[model samples]
Target: MAASVQGGRIGNLPAEANAFVGRQLELAEIAGLLGTERLVTLTGPGGVGKSRLALRAAHAAKAGLPGGAWLVELSELRDPDLLTNTVAQATRLTEQTLQPLLQAVCEHLAGAPVLLVLDTCEHVLDECARVVQELLANVPELRVLATSRQPLGVPGEHLLTVAPLPLGERDDAVSLFTARAAAAVPSFALTDANRADVAAVCARLDGIPLALELAAVRLRGFPLHRLLEGLDSRFDLLVSPARPRLARHQTLRTAIGWSHELCTPLERLLWARLSVFAGGWDVEAAEFVCHGGPLDAEEILALLASLTEKSIVTRDGDGAAVRYRMLDTVRSFGAEWLAGLGEVEAVRRRHRDYFRWIARQGEAEWLGPGQRMWAERLTAERANLRLAIEECLAAPEPETALELTGSLWFFWFACGFTEEGRGYLERALRRAPDGSGPEHTLAVWAHRLVTVVPEDLDAAESVSAAYVWLADERQLPVPALPLTGASLAVRGESARSAVLYGRVGQAPAADGGAEFFQLLTLALQAYLLASQAAFERCAAVAERLRTECAKRGELWMRGWGDFFVSLAGIGLGHSDEALLSAREALTAKWRVHDRLGAAAVADLLVAAQAARGEEELAARLLGISRRLWHAAGLPQLGRPDRTVFHREYERRLRASLGDARFAEVVREGWELGPDAAIALALGGVSDVSGP
Candidate 1:
C-alpha cells in the first residue's frame, strides 16, 4: 500500500461495480509492465474491458506506490484544453500558483511515486499525449496507465494489447457469461444439458467480453437456442470479412445495434432522446426531456426499465429513483440514429427547456431550506446542463442560450465556477442578438460580475456600461439588482452599493419572487458596510442574515455572513470572536470547495491572529492567504481601506520576528500541504509546522 503522508491521502479508486471474472494473466502482465516502464498503454477497442482491466491493475498495485493511484475518466470530456485542469481536479490537486498547469502537475508529482490511470484517452489522443509526455519527461517518479483505442505514442510508453477471452476451454468467456446470466436470471446455470449450448453461444460471439455480457442479458427472456438464433441472424446481416482487430470492433458495434433492434419503438425513441444527456439521468429528467412526441410521461419509466433489462442502458443507484446512462458506444449509435430521424432539434430543445427550468428553480429556492439540496442537484446535473447550453448555442435561436446562462448567475457564483460561468457568458454574448432586452441585460450584468477579479477592470467597466445602459432604459429585475450592487461594492463605490441594495426592498419579497436575490443583496449590503468601516452596522446586518441563513440550511451566503462578522469583529477589537467566526466560515467554505471564499476567510483569520499578537503564526497564515488569492485569480486589494490592516500586520510581524525569520516562517507555510492548511484554518490543530 502507498505509504501515508500526513494531510494527503494517496488513493481514491472507486470500488468495482461488478464481479471480476477472469483477468488474472492480464492483471499480472500489467503489473509487470508498470514495474519496468514509466508509461503503460492498454490499447483495445471500445467495450473491450480496457477501463475495467486498468482499474483492476490500479487497485492491485495501489499498495506499493507512495503518492497513490488516481483515475481520470476522459470519456465525457469534450474540450481537449481542459485536460490538465480535469486531471488536477481528479487528483484533488488545487492550484497554488499561476504557473502553467503542466508545470503545476510536474511540481505536484516531482518527488512522489504515483500511478495515474488515464481512462478513455482515445477521444483526446493529441492532448493526452502532450500532457503525458511532458509529465513523464519532467517527473521521474510518476507512472501513467492509459487506456486508449490506440497508443498515446509518447516516448518510453509500453503498449499492452488487451485481447478478448479464449473461446472454448479457458472458460474466461463462459465464466463471464454465467456470472452476468445469474444476475439477470437467478436460476441460470451452465448445467450439463445447457453447457454445450452456452459454450456454443460464447464461441459464436467471438469470446468478446461486452458481447457476451449483452448476450447474457438475453437469457432473461429467451432460452439458449432462441438467443443463439437471434445472434446468428444479427451477425449474418451485419458482419463481413475484416482484419482481426476491425472485426472485434465490428462485433461490439453489431451487438449494440442488435440490442437497439430488439428494443420497442418507444424504448428506441427514449434511447435516442436520452442521448441528449451527457451523463446519467433520473426518470424525472428523462420524462421531462423525452416526453411529448409519441411518448407520454407515464410510459417513460416502463420503457426505461425495459431498456435497462436489455442492457441497452445501465441502471445506477438502487433507491426509489434509479439513474440510467448508456455506454459511450451505445450513446454514439443512438446519436447517429437521432440525427438520421431529424428529431434532434426538438429533442434538444426540450432538454434545454427542462434544464432551464431547473436552473431557474435553483435560483428561486437557493436561500431556503432546500438550498443545500439544490446545490447538490445542480452539481449532479452539471454535465447535462452543459449539453443543454450547447444545444441552446447551436440552435437557430441564440436567445435561449442567453436566458439559460442568465438564470445560472447565482448557481455559478454560489458553486465557485466563476471562471467557467464567465466563459459561457462570453460565448453566449458573442452570439446574442444586438439588442437591449431582458436576457441581454441579464447576461451583461452576469458578465460584469464575473469579470470583477480586479485585473479585468477594463473589461468589467465596458460590460458595466452596457448593463447600465439597459438598466437606465428599463427597470432591472430583483435578481439583477445584486449584480449591480456587488459590482459597485467591489470597485470601492460603497455609497452606490448601499443605494442599489436599498432598492431591493422595494421589490416583491415573496418566496417565489427572487429569494436568492434578496438574500445576496443583504449579504452584499453588509459587505459594503464593512468596506466603509461601519463595524457596528455591519455586525448587526451580518448577524441577522447569519441567523436567517442558518435556519434555512444555506452555507454559501451564510459563510459570507460569518466573513462579514469576522471583519467587523477585527475592526471592533475582538480578536478571539473574530477568530471563532473566521474558523466557522472556513469550515463551511471548505465543505463546498469554494476556493475563492476560503481565501477570503483565510485572510480574515490571518488578520484576527495578527490582532492578538501571534506574529509568527500570523505571518505564516498571511503567506497562505497570498497563495490562495493567486490560486483564485483575485488581485490583491491596492486601496488603503482594504490593504492597510494587512500591510500593518505584516509590518508588525516582520519587525518583531525579524525579516529572515519571518521569511522562513512564510516559506514554511508556502510548503504546507492542502490538508494541513485547511486543518490549520479550521482549528483542527493550533500549529501547522510539523509533518
Candidate 2:
C-alpha cells in the first residue's frame, strides 16, 4: 500500500521474514493511537519487541498516510551531530544544498503528510527529542513513532509502554516459542507431552521475544526437557522477588549468557570482535577485521554460520550479497566481554584500518570499470566509514582521518553526498596538523573542490595560487589540475582555464593512476573549447572523452562529456545530433542522480528544441530547467559561459512567442517534478499540460 513520491520509495518498513505470532491487542491500540497522536513513543527494555511492534503498526497504518512511513535505524549511529542527516536520508530528502541540514529536513516535510519512525533512540535521546520537537512544530501534518528505552519527553509525546508478551495457556510468548522451535527442528510441535516445559521456559524468561527465540534455537541440539533444565539452573538464582522489572532484565541477560556459554571459544571471540563494526558487515569485512589470534581467516565463514544458527547474529540479503548484523542487546553483551578482554582499542583500530583500505581501493578504482559498484559499496559502508573516521579522530594521531576523508573524494563528489562530504572534509581539515605533505594537501584541495561555491570566487583564486606554490616548491604535479581549471572557468577566465585544461591533458597521468580525473579533465577542456567557439575541437575532445568513459563503464563523467558534445553540436548547426546527445546526457545524469548535470542538459535541450523550430517545447523546457536550477541550489549553471546559452535561447523563445504566452507555458513547465520534467525533455511524454 506504500506509494512512490518523486522517484523515492517512501514506505520502507522492512518486510517480516518470519510469521507474526500474536500481539493483536497491541497492534490495534498502536494503530488507533497513531491515527490521533502526532508523536508516539514506544518505551520498553532491551529486546522487549519495541522495534518489531513499531514496524508492524507502521506497516499497517501506511495506507492512511499519504507521505508514507519511513524507518530511520539509529542503533549504529553514534554521532548526535548527524541525527538530522540520518533522518533526512531515510525520508529520501536528498537536499543538494549547503543550507542547514535541519532546515532542509523541515522544509522538505513542511506541508507533506509523513509518518517518520525513529528506531533505537536510547543513545541519542536528547538530539532525537530536539529534532522530533522541531519537526512537530514546523510540519503540522507530520507524525512520529519512536522506539526507545525511555521517553523523548517532548511536549506532545504519548508514551506507549510495550511490555513482554503475555504468558498463558495459548498466549503470544508460547506461540513465538513454538514457531521458532518448528523453524529450528522441522519436527517440532506442541502436545500434552512437553507443553508444560514450554510454558515453564516462557514464564521463566518473562515472555520476552528475544530470550524465547534464543532458547528455541537450542532445541536443535537438546531435547525440550534438557533446554528447560538449563534455563532453570542458570536463571533461577538471578530472579528477585522485590523488583519485577529488574528480574526481567537479569533474566534476559542470563539467557544470553547461557547462549554464550554454548558457543565454542572461537565463536565467542568472533562475536566479541564483531562488536567493533557498526551497522552491518559483509563476509569479507568480517574475515579481515575479526580474524587473527586464535581465529584463522578460513574459519570465519563456519563460525558465522554457527553463530547465525544459534540466533546470536542475524543474516540479511542472500547468497554472495549477504550481510550480517547482531541485535543491539546481543552486540552490547559482546561489547562488554570485549572490553573485559582489554581488546576494544585493538579491535577498533583493525576496524578503522580495514575501512581505510576500502576507501583507498574505492578511490584508486573510481575511474575504472567498477565505478558504479564502488559507489554503491561505499554508500553501503557509510556508517562503518563514519565509525572509522571517529576512531581515527579519537586517536593520538588524527592525520589518518585526513587521509581517509581525502580518499573518498569521488564518493563525495560523483555520488549525491556532497553535503555530507563537505562536513567530513571540514572537520578533518580543522583537526589536520600544519603540514604540506601530499595527504594533507590532497585533503585541503579535495575540501575546496567539494565545497566550491560560485560566490567564493576569491577563495578559489587563493586556493589555486596555493596549489601552484605547493606544486612548484615540491616539484610535483598539481594533483587536482582539473579542479583548478574548473575554478578558472567559473571565474569567467576562459583563456586561463583553457591553458590549464590543455596542460592537464598533456601531462602524464599521476602515479597510482586515476583515469576518472584524466577523463574529467578532458570533459572540462572540451567545455572550455565549446565556450570559446572552437566547435570542431570541442566536438573532438568530447568524443575522445566519451569513448574513454564508455570503455571504463563510467556514467558520471561520461554524462558531462555528452553534454559538452551536445553543446558543440548546437554551436555547429547540427540540431539533430545536438538533440540526440542532449537526450543521452539527460538519461545518464538521471541514472546517477546528478541533478546539476541534468539541469545543464535540460537547458541545452531548450536550445536544441528551438533550433529545430519546436518553439512551444523550447519554452516549456526553459521553465523546467529554471526549476531544476533552483532545486540544485545553484544559479545559472554557476558560470557566465554556461548561462550565455540559456540567456540566448530564452531571448529567441520570447521573441518568437509573445511575453504573455511564453510566461504561461514556462509556468506550466515549472510545475512538473524532476522525474516528469526529465521524461518530458526526453520526449517520452507528449502532453504535460494536464494537471
Candidate 3:
C-alpha cells in the first residue's frame, strides 16, 4: 500500500496537488520519520511534487507541533546565501538582536516543537544545506522539512522519495481527474466505462500529482483526445502558458521543462515513445514497443530503470513483476512532441500487440487446473484489459474488439459489471465483421439470462432468438442448442424447444471450456420439469447439471442446480432433506439479492414447518409470507399460492390446539381462500380448513 496525503496546513500548493491519492503509506512513513528524525528531506524529480508532500506532512503534523509551523518557499530564492534569511523572515526574526539570523532563528525556537517547511532548494542547495545543518545543530526542538529534486548531500538528512498516486486508488490522480471532470460535466462519473482513459492519463503522467491536476483541469475546455494529442509533444506543448502562475505555485510546466532540458536526448525521446501504451506498461513491453535501431531491448530497459529512479516512470509494487506507469499530463505532452517528430502509430500498435498477447496468455492459463488462480490473474490485469479494449475499439475495429470482449467477459460479470458488458457487446455487434457477431452475441445474452432469468422472459426470448437466428444463418456447427431450447421451454414454448433440441441432441459431456450456457440450459430444464411433477427425470437431469457446473468452477450455476435438487427433496416428503436445500436456496437468493427467489424459498420453509406440525412457527412464517407475496406483486385469488399458505397455517393452528375458544377468533375472517383466506388469517371468519 502507498502513503496517504495529509491535507496541507501551510498554503501555496498548486490547485491540482491538493487532492492527494494512493499515498497512505507515504503519509504515515513521513509522519513517523518526522517524529524520529528532525531533519527529513523530501526528494524527487522536478514537477514530481516534492514540495507538495513536505507541505502535506507539515500540515498533518500541525497538531503534533504545538508551537505551530512556517513554510519558507525557497524556490523563489535565487541566491544560495538567502536561504536562512527567508526562514528568519517567516519566523519574524529581528534584524537588530538576531545573531547572524540563522543562529538567532534557532534560539527563537525556544524549546517548543516547531516544524519549518523549506521548499525547492536544488538551485540553492549549498545555502539551504548550510542553513538546515546549522538550524538542527543549534536548535534541538526545531524540525526542518525540505523539498528538492535531489538530495541536499548533507549528513543527518533523512531523504524520503515522493512518488506518484495510483489509478486504482480512488483517492489518487485518476480519481482527482475524474472528480474534476465531473464538476465540469455533471454527467461525468468514474465508471468502468471511462476508467480506461482516466487511468491511461494517470499512467502516462507516471501518476505525478501535479500533472493529473492539470489534465483534469483541462477537461473544462479540451476534449480528452485533443488534450492527449497536445500532451504528446509536451516539451513544445505544455509551455507554462508563458503566463504567471498562482502567487504561490511556480508553473508546473516550467518545473517539468527544467527537468526535460536536463535529460539526455535519448532519455527524452524514450520518455515520449512510452505514451503509446495505456495504464502501466511493464519494462519488457517498453523495450519491445519503443524498440529502435538506437535503443535495443536491454538498453531501453536500463534507461527506463534510470528514469524510474529520476521519478519520471513510477513503479507499482504488486509482487513478482513491478509495473511502471507514466502520468497522463506528462505522457501526453511528451507524446505530442514525439508525434510531431512522428512515432505515435508505430508505438501504439506495438503497445496494442503487447496486451493482445497478454490476453492470449490469460486464455491459455484458464484451460489448466488452476482455475481460481487464472481468475485472479485476469482480475489483476483489469487495467491492461481496459487498455486493450480502448486501443482496439475506440475506432470500433471488429476483429480486435470482438476478441478482446470475449477474453474479459469472465472478469466483468464476476466483478458485478453487467451494465458495462452490455455497452461493449452492443458496440462489438454493430461493428464486428459477419463471422464474429454471432458467437459474441451468444456470450453476451448468456450473462443477461443469468441476471434476468424467469422474470424477464419476454426480453430473454428476443435475445435468445437473436442467437438462434445468427447460428442458423451462419450454418455454423451448433455446439449447444439445447441450452437455448431449454430456456425457450421454460417460458412454455416447449413444443418448439423440444423440436429444436431433438435436431441437435443433448450436449456432449460438460468439459472445462464448454459454454456455460449448456449447463444452465440443463439446469433450468431440470427445474421446470420437477415443478411440473416429473420427479424421476428431474432428479437425473439436476444431478448431471450440478456435476457439470461444479467441474467448470461455476459456483453460481452450481447453486442454481442445487435449487432443482431441493424440489426433489420436497416431492419425496423428506422434511430434513428439503430443509438443507431450502437453507442453501436462502443463502443463494440473499447472496444475489434475488427477491423472487427469496419469496419462493419462503414457501419451502413454511411447507417444512407445517409438515412438522409446528403451528406457532408456521403461523408466524405465514404472516411474513403474506407480506412478501404482496411485495412480489402477486395476484389475489383463491388457491393462489398465498391462499394455500393461509389455509395450511389456520388448519395447523386449529389442529395443534383443538380449542373452541380460538374457533370464534378465526370464524369472522381468514381462511382457505382469498375471502375466506384473508378473513381466517386476520380473525374475521372460519373456512372449512379452520376449526
Candidate 4:
C-alpha cells in the first residue's frame, strides 16, 4: 500500500515501500480487532514482522476512520518526557493554545474516529503504556494498535501474539525463502532436486522470517549441501534438549553466528566495537569509536558495507551520512562476542574519550549560532553520554567522571537534566580522590552550579558560601564566582547579588575571554538588574545579551534574556509587549526543559494577561503557573520581585473574576496538568479575551 489521502491531509503512516511477503491471516485477524478493541498490541520476537503487520493493519483500518490512522515510531525517542511532544509533532497537531500537550492531544481526538498506531514500544514500554492508557481513557472514539516485543500490560489490552510463519512444505516460510533466494541469484529456483533441501532449511529455522532471509542471502556464497552441513554443525553445538522452547530463538542466533563466521576478522572486530553505541550512528561516529586495532579509518567503510550487504548491520537514510544500526537481536549477539573478546574496557575507554571530546566541543561552540545544532547533537548522543558515564564509574576513575560531568555543565542546564546532572556529579564527587586539587574543587563547584536552581535556596546558599570560602583561602580567582552571584539573586538578595555580579563580570575572562563565559556573565548581570527593578537598565542589558545570544546561536541565556525582557516590559507598563515576550520566553524554556524558567515566564504571562483585562485567561494561566510550580518542585520558586508581583496580580484577578469564579478557574488550571498547562502557556495569545 502507498500513502493514502482521502482529503488533502497526508496521514503519518510511512509509505509501504517493499512488497510484504505474507501474514494474510494475521492481517485479517488484526483487522477484525479494529471494530471491537480500543487497544490491540501485536507482540512477537524481533524480525518476525510485527512492524509490517501493524502497518498493514493500520492501512486496512484507515478508510473507516475519518481522523485517519497515525503511526508514532518509538525507536529513536530517547527521553520519556518527550513522548507527548513527539506524538504531537507526528500528528501535525500544531494548533497553538493554552492547553497541556496531552490535553491538546485529547482535545484533538475527542469523539473523533481515529486509529493511533504506536510502534517499537519495547524500549519505552512503560511510557508507551502510560500515554496509550491516557489517550484511551480520554478519547472514547479513538482506538490504538501497538506493536511491541511484549505486551504493554495495560488493562483491557487485547493481545495478539505473533508467532513465526508455519514450517509446512508449501507454507509462507518456504515461499519467503524461495523469493529472497531468487533475488540473491536470479537463476536459482526451487527445482525438484533442491526442494527437499530448501524445506529442511525452512523447517530447521522454524519458519522465522529473518533467519530465512539471511539464509537466502547466503545462496550466492554457498551451495545448498554445504549450507545445510554448516547449519547442522552450528545447531548441534547450540541447540539444547533442556531448552526446547528456546530452540526457536536459537534459529536467529545461529543465523547471526553463521553470518558472523562469514565475515573477515576485521569486520567482526568492527561489529563488536559498534555494539557500544546505544542507538544508530553515522560513519563519522563509527570511525571515531570503532576504528582501532585491526580496523583503520579508511577500511571502516568497506568493512561496514560488507556487514550491511550481509544484512547483519542495517543501513538507513541516504547520502554520505547514512546511519547504521544492528537489529536488537544482532546487537545483543555482538555485545556477547565483545564481552568474550575481553575488549570491553578498552572499547569503552575510547567511547568515553570520544564523547568527552564531543562535550568539550559543544561547550566551546554553544554560545554561537550553532548552539541549537550542538544542543540537538548532544541530545541525540544522550544515550552515549550516559554510557560513557557508566563506563567511567565502572572504571572507578572518578577523576575522569568529574571532568566529563563538569564539561557537560551547559548540556545538563540547557537540556533540563537538572536532577540527572546532579546525580552524576554527586556520584563522581563521592568516589573522587580526596585532595585539595583542581579536579576536586571543580567537582564541588559543578555540583553547586546545578543546585543553584530557584527551588533549592538552601543548597544554593551553601554552595555560594563554599565558593566565597574557597576564593578567600586560595587568594586566587574562583571559577564559580559568577554562579555564586546568580545563586544570590535566586535567594532574593538582588542588591547584594548585583555587587558581586559586577565584580565577577569585570574579572578576567576564562579560556581567553571565550564568548560562552562572556555571555554567561552578561546574562547574570541582566537578571540581577531585572530583579532590582531597574527596568531601563534591565531592558538594555537584556537586549544586548539577547543579541549576543542570537549572534552566537545560544539558546539557554537567550531564553533567560527573553524572560527578563518580559519582566522589564511589565515593570515599564508595556503589558502587551510583556505578554508577547513571555510567550517567546516560555517557548525557549520549553525547548530546554527548564521548568524553573518556564515557571517564571508563566508568572509573568499571568500578570500580563491580567493587566490587559484578560481576567479568565489570566486566571487560567495562574493555574498553569501552579502546575509549573509542581514541575519546579516548589510552590514559591519565583524570584523575590516576581513573587510579590504574582500575588498582587492574583489579588487583582480574584477581585475582577470574583472569589468563587476565580477559585474555580484556578482549579480548572490545576486540572489542565503540567504538560498541557505549559503548552497553553506557550500558545497563549497577547490579547487573552476568551474564557
Best by TM-score: 4
Worst 10 residues of 4 by lDDT: 239-248
What are the per-residue Cα lDDT tens digits for candidate 1 across 50-123?
Answer: 88899999999988988888899886687999999988878777648778877887777667689999987866
- After aligning candidate 2 to the native by TM-score, how far in Å is the CA of 448 from where it should be? 3.6
Give the range of the ten consecutive residues with the poorest summed lDDT in model 2.
239-248
CA lDDT of every candidate: 0.75, 0.77, 0.60, 0.74
| Candidate 3 positional error at 429, Å | 4.7
For residues 122-184, what per-residue lDDT tens digits would candidate 3 score against the true structure? 667777878788878877787888887656767888988876666553547776677656765
Q: Using lDDT, rank the candidates from best to worst.
A: 2, 1, 4, 3
List the candidates' TM-scores in order: 0.56, 0.55, 0.55, 0.58
How does candidate 4 score on lDDT? 0.74
Candidate 3 overall lDDT versus native: 0.60
Model 2 lDDT on a 0 to 1 scale? 0.77
Name the TM-score of candidate 4.
0.58
How accurate locally is residue 443 in candidate 4, as Cα lDDT from 0 to 100?
62
Residues 170-266, model 4: lDDT tens digits: 8788899899789778999988899889998877665767667667767777798777776654333333222422222345565456456556799
- By summed lDDT, the worst window of 10 consecutive residues in model 1 runs over 238-247
